[model samples]
Target: MHRPRFLSGAIAVAAASLLTSACTTGSGSSADGGGAGGAQGGATVRLALTSDVTTFDPIRQQAASDYVVGRLMYETLVGQDDGGAIVPRLAGTWEQTPIGVTFTLKKGVTCSDGKPLTASQVAASLTRYRTISAGAAMTFGPGNTGAGTTITGDDKAGTVSIELAAPWGELLPGLANSTTGVVCSPGLTAGDRLGTGAVAGAGTGPYELVGAERGSAYELKLRKGYDAWPQYAAMPAGRPAGTLRVSVVRNESTLANQLQTGAVDFGAFTGPDAARFGKGGFRVEAAPLIRNFVAFNQREGHPGADPKIRRAVAQAIDANAFNKVFGGTGQVMTSYVDAKAPCVSTDPSLLTKTDPAAAKETLEGVKIKLVGSNAVGQGAGNTYVQEALRAAGADVQLTNADNGTWATQVMGNQGDWDLTVFPMIYGQLARGGVHFIGDEPADGRNFGAVDNKAFLAGYGAATTTVDQKAKCAAWQKAQKALLQAGDVVPLATVNVHYVFREGVSATIPAGAFDPVTLRIAE
Candidate 1:
């Protein structure tokens, strides 16, 4: 979960980028099929990326753009399908054990370096990943860290076991995240170089990084005889593009324009530019990208420390009105988790209905500071929020910073802001629990300094339970606690639109497209 710019799970304004790690919805394909194998499959598929990746190290990736490149270069042990159900990838099969999960490797899977992918290498990678100060591993168990996890590999048995110090129902789904991508020994040896895009053959996916031009484009070529494709039921029966030229086109209009001119085979858009290709011709796959919500800082001396003030701020704004800013292409959220996440609450009582009169009465004369990431069209939403609070008689100040600054100041808890319309794409409740249930930031990425006993209790139950019905019930309780306490306000879910040229198609899950699922006609 990096700084979300649309597809990632950090924070975003709208459907900002393309492809979530594994979850997506809707299907878009072309009837014009390409010839079989060789030249056709050998053809280069030019795709569009809204931003450039800061690193190639999957473990250290922090933005949606980074995932765009990482997904193509790395493969996870297990994968989630369109329905967010666990499916096999590098691991041929897996089973839940008392402590954690054990996975048996698929015999033929090889690293990009053309060597056998050993369970020892996978175990070592996971071991190293757990030690990294920040990244998905921290959230994989939702909050468990190095002190609470262990990994072991048995090459003779072709198995790898991940044992958690505590019960975590999300162990499988967490491993499916792009950030948990298993790296080869070469990649682990590369160390810091992995973060700078200087290492190759560190991944176990279909493509290998061959060239990179920062802020411009990345070049990758398909691995010959690569056969570890995830057997997603809806995957188009076609070969992967022989070559991938991922061009960085930061503008939505430019990405849409490129799709129409045959300059790029595929690109995702979440703004007005999406309307340009909806009438036919281009293939389109759409999915709710991320759930945008309102979160308040509860640090002492802050306006948000009082639940009444937080509720008043929540009531001042309308989720429907906010959704309209993105052309009403998203669903109004009823809980902190996105609609796609398992155990997400659908209880309408969890939200406070718009009541400007009550809000104005409570918030009048209150001074507040609002912060947001300037990525995509987030500023427009920030302006709307500013005006809403101002109209409520509160002296509101809004600051829109670049994704980096916002993540550092706001997400890193270095700023003095009171509230934010935060957006994220975490695919599971447990995967995102770290944000709502701890005392300090180090405990659970609780940047707001939230201290909710009820929320933590509910979260504990949900993560500890293996029963689906019980888990969902516990999750609902957790969400209710957050909403009722005014700790977080659910808003809406923005949809990411993947528009593709004819003869090329891809499946979109949840927030983003799976690069391995990409199919191009020869």
Candidate 2:
């Protein structure tokens, strides 16, 4: 059966720019620390988090912390498995028509409050998110022209249909994003006062919010009747029979101590912690994520704008050296996008080898500034670049900022830095993802910019071409052309590692943590 298509090239490209965005939700919760929590089977799974979620409101949530909790409490229209295949959730099935896409809700789904999940509720939630979330607006919205989509609900038919004002290529993948979690009407304008009993956040997720203590901890209980995970038609005797207690174990020492004492069941580790956990008797589950890379500002007047200089820096930096600093947890990058992605280029030039001699000859007193965006937590990676550039006899300087500052200043500012570092969360096989380098939101983004013909041409076919096989081929060619241009240099593949004790196991996705599927080994 034909599935929903990806958005236009512009839609996917715009989405890529903000995937690592430092935008804040103002909920006042710190999410940058490690966590530990879980208990024995079917009792209570205790987790230590660096920070607890600030809000249960899905659309307004900006921190990864919020999604960890929100995802367990709410359900989206559809979801992807570990293999990246799209599966039905709240949406039983979907089909694309000339005007737009239509979705039929799964039968018998109900909210945590015991209200039936209605088509109108799902329809309103999608529209509300598009109106409130800037990121979602850019994805499903009209062509930068602001026309947007027309949405309608058929309660009797249990379906919702959406027609875009412009050419949209991917609808299912866009709606399946975490930001589009569906909720009842009352949830649309309700304040996110989670735990005060002021509002019981309603959704169709497996777990329900029992209560929470702001900044310290939160609790989740399996919904009595939630059967979303098909294997659990009749929940096993020990399944959906436990409470989840996630605490804010912010300090590294305390988190390590808790893991040793069995006070917590799981924790995500990086830097030294991951290496330490490897030998610390904990089972380390390493999931490959997109590599962090530097995008050289290729705009006119920028010192790195010259293609030759861009290639020079690409060959100077050592990808392995950057991974070594992360306690040997990362791998050298293989492509401009994540290696597992379909749209990634296979060109050998992508893995540019470090050549000090060549880089030195290419650079004659040419100095460039490298800006490190802390959103990806790869600050140490920037130092390696400075050392490599200096070794090649090129003058180099580094400026680092927390995500908030980096998001405000460097993301769109032209001629500010020769290089900037960030991660990629390529969606829809990176159809629009590979084309993000041009001026639009991807082009220095706050302005209108476009890419070369080869890149744009490939992206156009990949997104608009109806033949699926031909589309994939088009995306491959587009990515190759971009990598050959050397506008951006991918450094290394970073793994988001989760540490679990002997009795615990986790089912985390590539780019996200899945608290609901977290299980205690029998």
Candidate 3:
């Protein structure tokens, strides 16, 4: 089965969706004489994961679970702060040129193998990533994955330059994705082994993977001389733990209990268990996990192929009522992309409203196959969807499967479903355009077979400009077109809460934690 499509490009942007005590809250750096390693300091910071990572390769990571661990072991050229601003990572500084951007590598950067990192190596790694990521459903971030882009490096000048195929305004933000992590010579040569965790020394991040027990646990050790932390304007004053241990526990209750017992230092929770951490003096961070929505398989022979049926289905969904199903922990979404995305539609008039009378007249006796993923609280949400549709006189068949199987069936050529509740995590606004106007799934991301000419025109106009104002204006038009045609119906944005033990802290931006800002209070 293919990896689940949810959280395909898991980099998050800080917005109204993010709820935390502070953007940068930590204390103590390596230079503070605290020394390194859990043994030297106190005890290792333990993390809990709801699922095991799909792959160790940053380039192939498809789920949020992978990103949580992958970010520490792999370094990107740039990274996004809580406010979605681009920040330097491996590149100490950068400047935009006419065609693209140029970056200067930090002076003391080194790979896990203790070899110095060079601009030439970074260029080669980027080229490899572009070649491997072609025609894939997601590129981890926005902008084309260097399909026709040119990259060059000068080791003597300590510079790497990227010239895109076009004037894509979000190129820098796209580079912030962990998928662009530079692979060193050892990892580049390890081939498939590198992707499978069978090789080491291929990464240039702060931590290196040292041990793994498949579904049980994974261990990472901080590099001794690592000095490539991003220059955040403000942050807590401590360094990451010398040792980072990620434990995979499938049960949410078990994971929550462990946090209370002080067995785990950190864990992200989406369900009701999150409330337990709120009152315990644990540091908490909350951000939108995914935008829950529904889409029609507009291919011929499907009920959704008819415009009237599609409209009726859209009219039957009550976004506010759906939000309550998740215990009111989520925000109602106004567009295909979440509110965190730039230029999202804030006008409710553009969307279809709940009209039970009209929906009943149009959808009576209509047969519908409703598919959904069981991950996170999607099953309950899907149930809400099924009951609403049934009330409108549609014969709905609901199939809520495991995340992986659900993705394979929905995106495959099986034609097994008519409508689906899809929960998506977006990296850039342009990525959402791919879902509504692209080749069908198994080959492309548009599983719904959407064919809205207005949406296409608006999206095309947005891509032609690099100006933020013009681009966002065009995007507003594009999203309005999609909503009016009922191509995709957005429901709610779910929040994932990150809880840390009383004395532990880290800077979280866009919901993802910054490794360098981790601190344990003495």
CA lDDT, every prediction? 0.73, 0.59, 0.71
Tens-place lDDT per residue, model 2, 1-522, is: 434221101212222211110011112111111111122225566655555565677776655556666667778887654434456667767776433678887777788777788888888888777777766744473352244677788999999888777655555556666768787766665655432322554666766676778787667666655544422111112222256666665565566565667666566654355566766567776655546776766567766678788788888887778777665666666565555554455566545567878988887588888777554554677777777888888888887766556654455463367777655445344433533534544333522132556776776666554455776789777767666777567777667666766655545443445555555443
Q: Write the per-residue lDDT of candidate 3 for residues 151-264, one digit (tens) a residue.
A: 788999999988766555666667777777788878878878877783566888877888998888787777776777765545554445666676666666677787777666
- Using TM-score as the measure, the top candidate is 1
lDDT of 3 at 231: 51
Q: Which 10-residue window of candidate 1 scores lowest in summed lDDT? A: 20-29
- Model 1, residue 81: distance off in Å is 2.3
TM-score ranking, high to low: 1, 3, 2
- Candidate with the larger TM-score of 1 and 3: 1
What is the lDDT, from 0 to 100, of the residue 127 in candidate 1? 84
The TM-score values for the models, in the order shown, are 0.87, 0.83, 0.86
TM-score of 1: 0.87
Residue 371 lDDT in model 2?
78
Q: Total clashes, candidate 1?
A: 11
Q: CA lDDT of 352 in candidate 1? A: 89
Q: Looking at model 3, which ten-residue stretch has the lowest summed lDDT?
A: 1-10
